[model samples]
Target: MSTAQATTTHDEIVATVTGIVAQELGVPAESLAPDADLRSVEGADSVKVLRMIAKVEREYDVELEDEQVFAVNSIDGVATVVLDTLAQDAA
Candidate 1:
């Protein structure tokens, strides 16, 4: 019965995801755009993408579906999934 999870906003999720993606890809967070595909970035690979997803899940305390995770190609998509997952839990 904790409302702690409700405080997160979509912008915050996108910002957090951008940071995680940047960290995993060994790139500067400022270099990433919200709609840019992380996989298309230099130095990115499947392993790194998975690591980013794992870190994102850990950060939000949610387990994302593999289908959704695999379909996500940008920070915006990841943030959408996280927000959806959190909203589902809230329901």
Candidate 2:
């Protein structure tokens, strides 16, 4: 994909993932950002984070390896991993 297309796709995925996280964690969507530290969010624990990752994997129909999922510390990282997985599947 071209640079513009890749950026657009990443942004869209970020928005969707952010929405999912907010809904699952009972936080306002506006409170989540691409660089936000998910673990630092109120009421967020390891279990919740894992749950969120599971939900995301289900939503995108992509299985994220546990190591990668655990290593994700921000929304942008998760988005990147999801996009990368999608690209790999498309290939």
Candidate 3:
């Protein structure tokens, strides 16, 4: 598998997720802090959040539970859940 497809470090996941969220929200990735609340961002909505989740799943090749997905409110939260999902798959 390519490096992008393989399991990556938390920092890398955070970076990628930040990019996805930024793209979905039409904001700068650099402007998104790791702990930034996505729902609080301008123009954020459920559809956009779900779209970001879909992109994140495609990027990481891990499926997240709906509960976990809805519980996500920050970039760090998403990265943590992604890491957990990857770990579960590996196990």
Task: State each model's CA lDDT, in order.
Answer: 0.90, 0.84, 0.89
- Compose the digit string of candidate 3's lDDT tens values, residues 1-91: 3455455889999999999999999998889999989999888998999999999999988889999998879999999999888877776
Candidate 3 has an lDDT of: 0.89
Which candidate leads the pack in TM-score? Answer: 1
| TM-score leaderboard ranking | 1, 3, 2
> What lDDT tens digits, residue by residue, belong to model 1 across residues 6-89?
878899999999989888888899999999988899999998899899999888899999999999899999999999999998
Evaluate model 3: give its TM-score.
0.91
Which window of 10 residues has the lowest lDDT sum in candidate 3? 1-10
Q: TM-score for all predictions?
A: 0.94, 0.87, 0.91
Residue pairs in steric clash, candidate 3?
A: none
**Model 2 lDDT per residue over 11-90, tens place:** 88899889888987899989887898999987889998888898888877789998888788998999999899888866
Top lDDT hit = 1
State which candidate, 1 or 3, has the greater TM-score.
1
**C-alpha lDDT of residue 12 in model 3:** 91
